[model samples]
Target: MSERVLVPRNRGFLFLDSHPAGCRQLVADMWQACPAPAGVLEGDGPVALVIGSSAGYGLAATLAGLKRAGIRGIAMSFEKAPTVRRTATAGWYRTAATAEIADTAGRDLVFLNGDAFSDSMKEQVADLIEQRFDGRLDYLIYSVAAPRRTDPATGAAYASVLKPIGQASCTKTLVFDDEGVAEVREVETGPAEGDDVEQTVAVMGGADWERWIDHLAGRGLLADGFATAALSYIGSSLTEAIYRQGTIGAAKAHLEATARNLNERLGKMVGGRAVTSVNGAAVTQSSTAIPGIALYTGLLRGVLGDGLVPPIRQLAALWDQLTGAAPLVLDDEGRIRLDTWELTEDVQSAVAERWETATTATIADLADLDWFHNEVQRLYGFSVPGVDYSAAVATDIPWPDHAP
Candidate 1:
């Protein structure tokens, strides 16, 4: 470990650094709050592979599985390792801390830090699965969110954009600082141009999810009663044009379509199942990057207050549904609907009323802007309750050596 002190450096809403102890504390807190599964899932416990399992809902889901049920997991993500000069990404610290936590409970969490979208990485995961945790996987969770993806077959790169499709969109969004709500402005974005939608879909859509399942199936690595689910979102009409009907929306549509196809494919392979879960909005790194979501989520938090189901709760509910503790609550498209509480008629009406009249002057009253800042800060391991911000921290935490 390098002897260095780290504080969160903000470039607008994105954080430049992460704290290792705070990250561990955050995971420990989530573990403490997450309840155990009501019943056994797929046997005593499942060996799960969580692609993109470092942050947000993915991390929440991973923790839920580990604490609620005895899930020995393999996670994959591409996070920058720390050097003597620069600190590691938040995900890197999060993954390391979680592995350490897992060890105390006698649970194993093997992490493969590499490009999850590539065939070579998939091969590495397969070999590890075969050699380490029994040669079969019971559960797979796809939760990758990134701005760019390179096609493994053609070596072509595609970058995803968060812009509207078909028509331009303009809306009110928040721009804030550590103090409180700084400004509220109308952010306008142009429609997707040539190849924008396609590229975004290629980067964010279900092609990779299909690829993972196919690779695992081809290798005869999928266990009986196998189940897979990919996380998704269908936003409210408050920011529909720029979100649910935008370039990112097209990618989500393709993802849902792939889930349908994979549902059938998994059934044929091992009498297994696949589903896409439409989760509620939380202040994730991906959600905060969208044009007008900052304002929306703040208002949402204010209106919903304690009523809003946190990501960990929602994920734990998902685990229960998948494991027969409860029935799956699906929408018309056969996708799980965990966003129901977030999109309730009462909640949306309150938020929409606030959206119409919220200005820089009244944003504090109309929205939980400070809460948004706090959540965003917590995502990068700052703003945590028990962390020592000014003290010297061991910045360069090494990834655990868990080779199979």
Candidate 2:
């Protein structure tokens, strides 16, 4: 037998793998470490399933929905690697943490590890629902994000490319290597052809969401009055050329369209409804991968640190709407409204103006780049409070439900 290689884990952080007992301890610690947000619910619900439910706003949404709706049981699907070799995705650690918390609370939880876009995965999920749940699901959340997806209709695999709307554009980005500020410029890296746009839309957009809903409904697995939701975002114009106005934006537009169709389909099913929550900007792994968003998010983080509304608070608010604690306001486009706050006239105006006037000496004052960097790091389980950074650690935490 060959010798096993040890991969380095993020020591002194919550990303470390904990065995079953350690996982349990970590859950209890986090519960005590963070206070429940104001107005959180403490009850039990019908049942909920959070797809792509491991990290970023999705994870937060899952927790908030459960806490507020009193959801008793949850079935989640997360695409993550094993922690044994330390090569696991960050979501692997996060799912472990979530499972530990749910178990400690006596909430019945079943976690599925696989690609949510796969048809066989849906069958497996349906079977799990029938066996573990009482053949019905009350709440469903679609939150998967992939750089590439195989189109069900065409059987073609397309990779999403992020680029500016027009000619080359350069912008300043925060550099953590340099103590305070540095100028990082980006140009359009790829051409977004018409077919590329359509293919990207088909793969990453709303078709998968529709398929999931149809599958559940056709199988009679959705309960009466059930609700399904998908989370979307529209960033500021500073980054919109690469995001909202570009290929990804086209995909999001399609996603919003799917929401309308799902609403009608669900309405005809059992008085059920479908909702799409246009969420606020946050420093997520996916967000970081998008060019220019890092700079935008860093600036927003600085602004937020100065007492502006944070993404977590915004997510909590979205959860409130999901649980009927708050009403969802819609824009003229017939979509749930939230992006306006982040891409507000005032906020966008400031970022755009700063982008024009910013230089190496002036970029720091243009926005809170430092704050954004810290928040971005925090999102990855780094720079958090109460965690020591010098501890020896191992990444081989065993999955409680993993069968050899």
Candidate 3:
């Protein structure tokens, strides 16, 4: 066996190994806690396809569709396969675990692992839809978050950057160390140079999402009255400099524009709808890498506590709206605003006050770093209650069903 034990090393807050059992337990918990109401999903045969379905909002959207909406889901993800020398990525474990449980419950969901930003992958999913989904896709949830994406046509890989657009930004942020200790530090980032914004948009923008819809519709796989949602974020003024107004912001803007175009296209073609769901800030794998989100979410957790809505619940609300159980809640820009709780006047006022006074000492009181840190660990299958970390585990977990 390899040195698969979870140990403390000098890698800052970065964790490279994952626990398979822990991941399974977390998935099981979500499956049990998730609310599933019959007759809410509306249709006789509801189907969904989730790109980047292994973790975070992607995973939440997948589960929300399955449990909340009663949809048959096909999860498309690219996760590294586990080998004897090292553990697979947490997403790999999560996907495999999810498949095992779905199988046991006789629920309909399958995993396809591969690069999603490629034409071949798109065609492959189309074929899967033909075989498994009766050739009609009712929902497409595009929640991909990657550092780089290789253009399927040109083979040019564009990496997304988190820097601001016009000027540099210096803000206070929180970072966790190897000992799981949290500290506040002043981090400076921004002012995209060169073709940074263009590259970011190229990688993170709506072009790929549009291409997917185009391909699916062209292949006659989109169901009548189909719907698609691309997950996005429009943070508060606290982190807007490095987020909403940053290079990533340009990418998100392009994503929203593409949604409008796709909405028009879908309406004309199939009576379908496309929306960019402006989701709230939460402790996600991608959000942790952003400049100011850590501090923002920390204060958010402290101020809101139980008032804060989890991404999964928000996604369930998305299902409710899409299924006609509720009306669509939109902002003036025509995007769904699930972030009203995050940007509330009272909550933001408290967070703003905390941000002003937050420091190495006061951060513990003003911000909930412990909560943030624990949530992050839960993503990687660590810090989960009742998991025996000392016991040896198998790394060669299979897909438990169909493979891509």
What would the TM-scores of all predictions be?
A: 0.96, 0.84, 0.95
Over 63-154, each residue of candidate 3 has an lDDT whose tens digit, in order, gives 77777777775888988888766688889989987787666655677788888899999998898889878899999999998889888888
Q: Compared with the true structure, what per-residue lDDT tens digits does model 1 show for residues 228-343?
A: 99999997898889888999999999999999999998898899999999999898988988978888898999898878788889898888777666876777787999898988
- RMSD from true fold, candidate 3: 2.0
Candidate 3 lDDT score relative to the true structure: 0.84
Q: By lDDT, who's the top model here?
A: 1
Candidate 2 TM-score, C-alpha based? 0.84
Worst 10 residues of 3 by lDDT: 1-10
Order the candidates by lDDT, highest first: 1, 3, 2
Choose 1 or 3, whichever is better by TM-score. Answer: 1
lDDT of each: 0.87, 0.65, 0.84
Per-residue lDDT over 1-404 for candidate 2, one digit per residue giving the tens place of the 0 to 100 score:
11223222332222342222232333334345333546545544567778877766677665555545556545455544653344345566567777766666666766677778778878888877777778888888778888777755567787776655555445555444434335656444555756878777876799888888888778889998888888888877677767888888889989988888888888888888787778777777678777777777666654455545544455567656665677866676556666666666777766666666756577677667656655555554544555543543344443437221
Once superposed on the true structure, which residue ranges of model 1 sit more than 4 Å away at CA? 39-44, 177-181
What would the C-alpha RMSD of candidate 2 be, to one decimal place? Answer: 4.6
TM-score of model 3 relative to the true fold?
0.95
